[model samples]
Target: MSGQIKYQWRITKYNPDYRDENGYYTLKEEWTCPSEIGKIIDGKEFTLEEYLDIEAKYIDTLIAFIIESGLNTLRILQLSEQKISTEDRSSVLYETEFDELILEEDKIVTLNDIVIISKMILRNFVHCQLYLKDRFFAHFGWDYYMYIGSSEKSLSAITIATERGLFVEEIDSSPYYFLEEDTTRLVQWSKKENELGMNEGDEELLEFPLEELRLIFNLSSQHPVVGNIKIKIEYKDFFQRYLNHKMDFDKYEYFFWGGY
Candidate 1:
């Protein structure tokens, strides 16, 4: 051909324990092949095959590196929010690849010992296209979420709420409250006495512990809760006062974590 040629390669293996029915990975490492190998317009031009044959050696070098240095650690990051660190070092997630290099019958790491590696990397990527695709989905365990709020932060509509008695604010609306052994989903709502609108007074904080709050709702099948996701739910009723506001504990349910 008279024009320049570019390519890419895909290397994938499936483990039933780590993949779904369709073989999508639930845990995986990923990387990309190089693009831009300069131009054929004015540079010394060779046949496309000649160009590719020369480029293949670089990929070979990369595979050799994989067999030598190990892959990065897998971080169990928040699938819901982005955290900013205040340290001098800029922290970023490391890309992971083949978790534990599985060797062939013989355990060895070398280019000559292709039979030892569980995945065949050197032989792959020989003909892939040059552009990077959005393989964000390829990162394992990066899925599973129900988006809430208009903020850039994505919180699920539901979470395991525990430590039911104490609530502290994270954002004006969010609570830090999750790192405890307990958990919960934060739900946005209007305060009881007001309909939602920014100009209106800020909605009252939802710190009423669940134990006492449940009584106010007289939680029942008819209770106006945002969630019924749990199978085993029990009810308790108690009376308490907040600030100067006093109300019967038998008819209300403060915003439960399971709802919007």
Candidate 2:
């Protein structure tokens, strides 16, 4: 019962799929917890609770160490790669929590409201992607690339390659984007197509205007630029007697007033 506390640590190599001669691998270190007084320090003597606690603490410590080490590591890597932005390799760890204040069931629908909600959702998705990139790619030897969007069925999504991963940005849509005449029509058409067992034979048959809102981020970019690069409008919206569609055709009307 009076044995002195001892600690053991070992560092091992980490190999990822997308490894290159110049690419770096992680150095994983295993740290065993202090052994109990009377218990043998073998695998059988480790209790679940004690093991879990030690594992959790050890992982937390590892994350912190990785973050600190990554700062210098990333700098050197960037320098070697001829990249200037140090923030590009910053840790992407992010926390997502529901905001009660932004959860109102009813609010006056406006173009601004739609834009705000869309931006918030996009920002959250970007943050999460960045965090993952830091954890998996930056921390390990792999490269992480992502493009997040609202729907895959969207006509605008046609240009995206299927191999690339897609993530749906979630946000409260009812308050901002009202279920107006056009939306109702689209839903009805969609239901009709579903009931008839009609395959999406032609792009013109779909009612939802096929318009898609998208955001793409390139983690490998030296500047790490995130922007609304492309907008594709598939269908025309009829307000009163006037028809509005085609991003370039109705630039003033939609760009200035319509919520994107």
Strongest candidate by lDDT: 1
TM-score for each candidate, following the candidate numbering: 0.17, 0.18
User: TM-score of predicted model 1?
Assistant: 0.17
lDDT of each: 0.25, 0.24
Query: lDDT score, residue 5, model 1?
Result: 12
Tens digits of per-residue lDDT for model 1, 1-260: 01111111122222235767874666644222212223342354334454344334333322332332232111111122122234312212111232233322111234433221212222221111110111100011112110111111111111111121111112221121111224333322233444442222112324556544434444432222223221111422222232223332233233323333
Off-target runs (Cα >4 Å) in candidate 1 are 1-180, 185-187, 190-207, 220-255
Please give, for residues 1-260, the per-residue lDDT of candidate 2 as tens digits. Answer: 01111211111112233335663433332223222323544434545455444333323332333343232122111111112134423313112222211322112222333333322222232221111122211111112212221212222222222212222222223121221233212111112225553322211123322222111111232212221122123323332123232223332222111111
| Clash count per candidate | 16, 1
